[model samples]
Target: MLVALLLLVLALSNEVRVNGERGGRQCGANPSLKPRPHSVSILEFGAVGDGKTLNTLAFQNAIFYLKSFADKGGAQLYVPPGTWLTQSFNLTSHLTLFLEKGAVIIGSQDSHHWDVVDPLPSYGRGLEVPGGRYQSLINGYKLQDVVITGNNGTIDGMGLTWWESFRSHSLNYSRPHLVEFVASNDVVVSNLTFLNAPAYNIHPVYCSNVHIHNISIFAPPESPYTVGIVPDSSDNVCIEDCTIATGYDAIALKSGWDEYGIAYGRPTENVHIRRVHLQASYGSTLAFGSDMSGGISNVVVEDAHLYNSKGGIEFRTTRGRGGYMKEIIISDVEMKNIDTAISATGYCGSHPDDKFDPNALPLLDHFILQDMIGTNITIAGSFAGLQESPFTNICLSNITLSVNYASSTTWNCSNVFGFSDSVFPKPCSDLDNPSNYSSSYLSMLSMKGKTMVSGSVSMKK
Candidate 1:
């Protein structure tokens, strides 16, 4: 019995290593890479407290100590078992936040007390920032080769109080996120329990070679909450074996920013999310936004389980979001009580407020959804904009559904099995375009087996 328990605990451990760019195994146990060269623990840098209340001064001292250490390259910062409360913390290259068992890092809930600086300076290991410009809040400039792992520890964001205020004001001055990794490379965050984020749960922006695994992310179940993972035009990232429950999109990928994306020459690409379980409060379980800063490509989501999500499998782009979504492959997904099984819509016309100007592009093409099973599919099919872009080369195969026929429209299409007459057909085509075909094409894309739904073969034309 003791051996079995130990094996179970070992299976849950989040040990990550240098995995290849979508072609190699995670390198934690690989003998090729050695341990991090140096370790600078936070306890050694004056972090105080025994897992409770305001340890603000201790953390401040640690930051200043890290500054001195940064002058001569960085070192790993370790936080042992305790509940330490503070505003925010910064990470530099070669630094690691190793939270041992029973350690809890709690954030203060007061947004006004939470101060942040603008355009955080780059902390490049060797690259020099411009002489005049200093760093921004939580400066992580050019930070690379870092790992933040919480083994049986909790990183609490104390966000319930802020969530209440966010409901009152949607666009009022928002607070900073709980944890953010910006402009970094070769970063890994695994085996942590992140809860009650003030804003977004995790933001890895403009990063490369990033991996996040086995994180159990939790937020408020009510409405008007934030997202789980907002990868703003990031590249070469993988998030696997995580449990994300949020009010907004569970995982949101932002790429094209109207004119900003094209000007910056950056698009969110090469992302893979697999073996994830998500439960959303309001928004889609997995979504590509209408506010994509650049464009996104080469994304794959497989072996995921979603429970009670507001919507599932969504692709939305608006007039200001000019990025295209293509080369997406979704397979072996199981969902329960979702609003939309699949939704795709694009932007039309233009918006001048966006800094990254968007151009017209296909909403979704070369997308495949295979081996998906779901129930309560309120919105079952794909929707393309009439005035905007149309989805091309979209295919759904080996999908099975168990929905009420009275609420659904019809279900029968090429290559789809196990749908019913109640399934609705979301029209996908360029209807609002004057030059293209104006007529809308609406059809059910899957049919239920006769033994599955009332022993009748309901055909649709």
Candidate 2:
């Protein structure tokens, strides 16, 4: 059962009546309902119950009323503007929130308003506090064919208070996700601005056929944000023409590594992120890792612009994770003032342990980086031999990098092949020693008179 159903039952049991609206009634109270019936509109249950202003309790009542159709077919929730203050809303299948211009859905400042029963499978073991732990402003469940769009209005979390509290708290403190889609399908969020979020801005977890377009997410620069959009181990997710200004990775995919085992080794693949503009994030502009317990592959990013970002185009993995990242193509990437233009790091370092075995570990292979242009890449290229693994089957071609800050790129050459146009790693003896490597691996690197040295650039294969 969804938490929305629980909230509705609680609301009905309390007999919290507002105006002529009754519990267990449709928008107009017709029991003989059919698929694709007349579209019902909700506008009479705000602060004034007259559709003029925001009645917080009235709006909450309306939300509970909307949950009755969670298991039904198609419906629409219409909001014609004014400030609608309420707790979290659970979206149903075949449902859409069509906001007329000048509309705003503001979440309550108090956390208790969002308190609802847990909706997980287990009671007290697999998750914390069961279904009550999962909460969001607009939560869509395993439904299909849903759209949440607004022309010029905003979906404000009113999360300034939550942000302040999170910053004041410790790193172990967990916060609620703002807008989440769990196991849902065919969802689209377009032409809206999500501002001042409590946690991750927009998350589509364990979902497929998801599209998020033309969204503008803005949070304070000082906020210790985690991610703007997290496509967590979900497939067929597309994010395009979005502007993100935050304190963390613009987009990331996370799956609990040691926490979630190999039985659930599915990765976030078949993802396309294009035409995204990111500015001033604490993490990477477009990245994978951090939560690589599930693995990621077949991801493509094109026509992206980054400004003053901490990092750019990161691929990372750690020891406890059993996932692999492969067949990633990043092209037409332009950047300025980024922490690094390209970086790949492993959680298992140069020392081999139980977690570092090429035979059983995930492979990073068939990566293509083309038509990349950047200025002042801050970090040096990562060709260092880790205790666990080194890069394999990678290609970087047609790259034009200009370093206005420094001279020469860096390379350790112990594991990478086909590296050209280089400046540093003076002797390049790591490539000369064949016994330390496979037969033809060291013969594939060429780094002479390609471009002037800045930080460093290396291509691994």
Candidate 3:
């Protein structure tokens, strides 16, 4: 077990190195978007961009007409500078939807105009409600080579009404997202500004080779459950060079939910997030799971600036969540004015139903946090792991968190163990005992009733 775990860590290290060395601003050399063979303007299909007319059918017909070019190198649908108000529109495969500067596609405020869809197989229900969800403004499913790029174009989900309804508990279904892509591959969304989403700004679920870059996503700080980017049950996702400020989690990496998620049995893995600025007024700047019964692993987050967050980095799971979160590395992070710099709790989120396995324990291990610095933090760290499955092999190196001296407790820990190297304000004794991990790779293991990091991997200061 030890050898296998070490090999996984080393292999992850090598993968990170390769990804970091890739040239150009693209995600793994994301091919430069070339011009499509055929192009059409929305006006060609008699779509008015007055921001008042419901152009839902105009947009649909335009895409239907473009379906002819699917086999002939695909096509492009260009939306010139104007406010194009519409409901939800599904994108076709091998298509590029480009928006010129000052172009805005607005989601209609009429809730009845939106389409309702069945809940995800993993969740078994809508995320906030117990039934179907309003479809996203722009959606792509089972697609290949789809790009939604623009010259800083905008997709606005005027969600104030939705937010009010949600707060009043007056909604019959879950709110909609600004953009979502499900079960899709080779998708790219860049150079856009997303605002006032009913829920999430951008969501990619059950997808692969998804790249989201050079985008700004935001919602009102008072908006409830407004996430910025959610990568759920998705693999090979690259989210970088983005700025996101949301009412809730800036980025939540999830797999599945409880029994339904476990039944799906597909883990979200091999993800990379870098070079981003994130702010969450009421949630974590970055988070992993509360509904991750399908498992999440092999993620790397580096060169990030997290500021003004309720929590900086958090790992949330409940008793009934049967999954694992492991082989993750967070490095080169700078935090400011954070309520909690780091937290890992086995208590958060709700269950889909009562058919969850109470004995299904979630594993949390091999999390390496290195080269982190924080200032004006209320609490330094809190590690609350499960007694049945205590978190282990959490290696912290060169972490300096400037916490409030007036606060009674800077760090709180229980049922967790690891090696802490040069952490400021000192972590709890459960993990403060540091070994020279600078020259050794580590794996998940605890022997003789003592939890610690043990292996042979090199880390630089």
Model 1 lDDT tens row, 1-461 = 32332232222111110121223422111112224445655667566655445666666676555555544545556678877776665666656567888888888765545653443222111111111221212335467666777575788877777677756654234455667777777777777888877667787877776777888888877735567887776776678888999877898887544555545546677776778998887888898866563677766676789878877878776655556776565767898888667767663224434243334443455554666788876656646553545566454545676564645443312221111111224222221122321112111111111011111111110
What TM-score would every model get versus the actual structure?
0.74, 0.73, 0.91
lDDT of 3 by residue, 1-461 (tens): 43444354445445454545464322444456788899999999888889998989988999999988989988999999999999899999989999999999999998999999999999999988898988999999898888999899999999899999999999989999998999988888889999999999999999877888899999888999899999999887778899999999999999999999999988887677889999999999999998888898877787899999899999999898999998778878999999999999998888887889999889997787877999999999999999999988787767899887757899999999887657888899887654423224353311200111111111100
Report how far off residue 137 is in candidate 1 (Å).
9.6
Error of 1 at 330 (Å): 0.7
lDDT of model 1 at position 55? 65
Estimate every model's Cα lDDT from 0 to 1: 0.59, 0.58, 0.84
Q: What's the ranking of the predictions by TM-score, best on top?
A: 3, 1, 2
Candidate 2 TM-score, C-alpha based: 0.73
lDDT of 3 at 13: 46
Worst 10 residues of 2 by lDDT: 446-455
Ranking by lDDT: 3, 1, 2
Q: Cα RMSD to native, each candidate?
A: 13.0, 16.1, 6.0
Output the number of the TM-score-best candidate.
3
Residues 37-130, candidate 2: write the lDDT tens digits. 3244456553532323435565456656665665555656677756666677677666667766777777777776665544322111122221
